[model samples]
Target: MLIYPDERLAVFIDGANLYATARALEIEIDYKALRAHFAEQSRLVRTFYYTAILEDQEYSPLRPLIDWLDYNGFTLVTKPVKEFTDEHGRRKIKGNMDIEIAVDMLNIAENVDHIVLFSGDGDFRRLLEAVQRRGVRVTVVSSNSTQPSMIADELRRQADQFIDIVDLAPIIGRKGPRRQHHAHYDEREETTREFEDAED
Candidate 1:
């Protein structure tokens, strides 16, 4: 559950992870609404969203969304994408903002009572533990609804609470006339399906 109401809260969003979660849920997060949802529940000290931008290119499709979040209430922490060649000679791009996220969370530990982390990268399990050691209650928001599950098992267990992203839709769902796309939903039950099945 979202322990919102009276707790002092801060949201640390792994932008890419959040996008995938919402995409899997077949919804676009109304960033404005998401802010309001938390504000209504607690004192929202800061809203941090971390992402990597492809500034090397003249154009990137995700630019607009990033711009909106920056202009709005979010504190945007972004970096450039790194291009590399794998052993197989395949080109790949990787963008990591883990260090930034971990640093910001530690910095804010004393400022807030509850910390909401929106990621499922499994690697963050240690980060969660560290934050909790400071007496900050942590809540992880990701999805088991995604194929292999977006929320990592260790992270869920480490946090004071685990909030499945599916449960947040009503607070963050689209408003106005929605031109629905085929949600790209799974062929099998989201929860019953094994994590390996959705790793794609």
Candidate 2:
């Protein structure tokens, strides 16, 4: 977590990926605290959060959290999830936000001195490299404490700094019991599970 108070900082959060990583560590993130933690570190530019919604549902499980984030300081980037049947006749959903995140990061790179990525997906290795080439420092935050390790080796290597999410648990984790079923927390868990099932 090398940071300077004068540096301009931007945060990009892969909502589902982060939710899964936190869950694996048996910790519930205090979103407000997470934002404040970074805002205190440097000149906060903007925080972007990405997710996909099952649009066909009358009321999505993610709606509440989405609304809260939108109303808060986070810039929400979302799209409708596509439902389709696989070759094996299994119904699946597809809604990857990699392109959106990459494009946004690239577009904002010149303005920010540092970029904080809150995801462990290996697919973003090239994106981080590209941003670094533009002289913007990149910090990747994800857990390496899980059985299989939540952060990808390549992605971790690509980042200028790698911070394990577990280390920040004390600062950004919820203060109550570990497994309480708060509505927003349950929604995030369900949404992450849905994405995982689709990928599988």
Candidate 3:
């Protein structure tokens, strides 16, 4: 991660995209540590995490993690996912948060000297360009080390700096003894995976 001591940094996280990327790399992020790591790099202004929730469900498995993040130095932005049938007559859930993240980044651009976007979505290339015009440096964090590559080429090119998340796993990822093999861990991972799968 490129860091300047005087830079005022803000983080915009595309929750589903990040979750999927991390899963593809077989790592789980420790949110608190990730925040602290960035804070150490510069004047951390804010960290925004955006996601979609299925409100119709009796209980959401992600509620615990969401609540944890909300109280742990993250600004949570979420909305209910919309369910609909496509032209092919297959059920699908719509929960894209790209606009929300772009809007927030634009709103905060003037205040922050740098933005670290945690997404590989190519749709954000224009947003990054707009933010750059305002003199804010943008750092995209996603992986190209995955089997098929997680970071979109255009998005990577648009960024002022591209930091692959796989390289930061040692600093931000959870350390444990084969976490995915445990039932409890699988339940939580599955919850995140379900939404991310729908997103992609």
Candidate 4:
């Protein structure tokens, strides 16, 4: 949570990874609150969210959330998931957004003073290094409070600033009446399971 008033900022969110982190922490993120909190911190330039969709599905549980985010200040980056059969003859879907997120951060590195990434994936260690080379300060937001610790050690060490999401829960979490066993929450859990298994 280090902040400088004049620094320009951009956010890159790895949708599935963030969802998993928040679920592990047992909190719901108020996207609006999150955007506003950072906007108040500095010159907020842009926010990017990445995910993969199953194009063949007639109905997707994540459609509502995805649509809401698209219309509400987030630039959505998505690709269709690819399905294939393994050698064992089991169908599997694969999707990964690391390259997309890295490209966007690198593309905008020179223009922004700060880049905030919302993912714990260790693969981004090099991406952070590259952006730091361009003089952009990188802040990684992920939790180390969970039982297994969602934040990767190498990624945490590489970031110029690391803010554990658990500490920001009070500021960014949704407030008022969320049932622990709500049907929507169940849907989200199911969606996470599918995506996590499919992720490459």
lDDT of all predictions:
0.77, 0.89, 0.86, 0.86
TM-score, cand. 2: 0.93
- Taking the tens digit of each residue's C-alpha lDDT, what string does model 1 give over 100-155? 99999999998899998888878888988888899899988889887878787888
Candidate 3 structure, TM-score to reference: 0.90
Winner on lDDT (1 vs 4): 4
TM-score of 4: 0.92
Error of 3 at 198 (Å): 6.3
- Give the alpha carbon lDDT tens digit for every residue of 1-200 in model 2: 89999999999999888988988898888888889999999999999999998888887867877887888899999999878887789777777889999999999999999999999999999999999999999999999999999899999999999999999999989897643233565655655676777765
In Å, residue 187's CA in model 2 sits off its true spot by 4.8
Clashing pairs in 3: none
Cα error, candidate 4, residue 181 (Å)? 16
Give a tens-digit lDDT track for model 3, residues 105-194. Answer: 999999999999999999899999999999999999999999889899999999999999978999999887543222233455655655
Question: TM-score per candidate, in order?
Answer: 0.85, 0.93, 0.90, 0.92
How big is the positional error of residue 40 in model 2, measured in Å on the Cα after superposition? 0.7
Write down the RMSD of all candidates, one decimal each. Answer: 5.8, 2.1, 2.8, 2.4
lDDT of 4 by residue, 35-61 (tens): 999899999999998988878988776
Task: Point out the worst 10-residue segment of candidate 4 by lDDT.
Answer: 179-188
Model 2 off-target regions past 4 Å? 177-182, 187-191, 197-200
